[model samples]
Target: MDPEDGSGWADVSDRSHRIDDEMDRIVERLRDLAHTQRRFQDLLDAVMSVGRDLELPVVLRRVITTAMGLVDARYGALGVLS
Candidate 1:
């Protein structure tokens, strides 16, 4: 069989397609990890902000807002204690 025949070309093409598909999957995984890492960092930052405040009211406000923001919510509430 000649190297330039259809069989050899088809084999090379199939391998190339498989490699491309694998590369796509890897890229998607990295993108997912990046998003997860960003979310984790945001939560960590929110925790640090809450910790930096000693006052109860400020801490409560930070907690409520951070929770809302993390979930992309437009509303949140914190009860006040008498």
Candidate 2:
């Protein structure tokens, strides 16, 4: 008997199983991405700490890099206000 028949047993189809598997894979990928993102944030924080501790010219560059990371932007700039 065809599973699609209205009067047959409530049978799940292979398409549904495939979709569930795809969804599971997507969820797992997102979890891994989140973990990587957290690690990047942690490292950025540590760099900022170093910049603060050293109080050197390179600190400004680190600040710009941190700001760019926050905005998901590839580039950043800093200017003195008049």
Candidate 3:
């Protein structure tokens, strides 16, 4: 069996296709991660702005919400009073 025969070529082609597909998926995930990071940064900035402009209770709530959102947590609490 020659190395360049149909079966060998098909095996190589299949492996190449799988590698390409995996690379494509990895690139897409990286892009999504980058986008999510930028969004998170924006949210952080918004939280900072709220904290700067609002009173203590509002600042604490906004900061907690921002933290929860970034961490994908459904709920959060902060002990800001004491």
Candidate 4:
């Protein structure tokens, strides 16, 4: 029976396997793009939130916390050169 036929076994031809592999790669790339987009949006929102605060300390704390959370870091700190 031809592999292309809707038999119980999957198609094992080289071209078919290559197509499947390419499809899997495309799906993985799309997922990564979606995750990155979400992170970017979260960062943008964090920046906007800090922008609304007029107090310096509050703004600094918000920025540090937001940065830590976005990067999944357990600890974060900010240093001023001046």
RMSD of 1: 2.3
The pairs that clash in candidate 2 are none
Cα TM-score per model: 0.85, 0.52, 0.59, 0.79
**Cα lDDT tens digits for candidate 2, 1-82:** 4756654343345667888999999999999999899978877785766567456557777777777776678989988689
Candidate that would win on TM-score: 1
Task: Report how far residue 52 has shifted in candidate 4, in Å.
Answer: 1.7
Candidate 1 residue-pair clash tally:
0
Model 3 clashing residue pairs (backbone): none
Per residue, candidate 3 scores C-alpha lDDT tens digits across 21-53 of: 999999999999999899878786866667575
> TM-score: which is higher, 1 or 3?
1
Q: Residue 30 deviation, candidate 2, in Å? A: 0.2
Index of the highest-lDDT prediction? 1
What would the C-alpha RMSD of candidate 4 be, to one decimal place? 4.4
Query: Candidate 2: where is the Cα deviation over 4 Å?
Result: 1-12, 55-82
Deviation of model 1 at 41, angstroms:
0.6
Output the TM-score of candidate 4: 0.79
What TM-score number comes out for model 1?
0.85
- Global fold similarity of model 3 (TM-score): 0.59
Give Cα-based local distance difference scores for all models. 0.91, 0.75, 0.81, 0.89
**TM-score of decoy 2:** 0.52
RMSD of each: 2.3, 5.1, 3.9, 4.4
Evaluation by lDDT, superior candidate among 1 and 3:
1
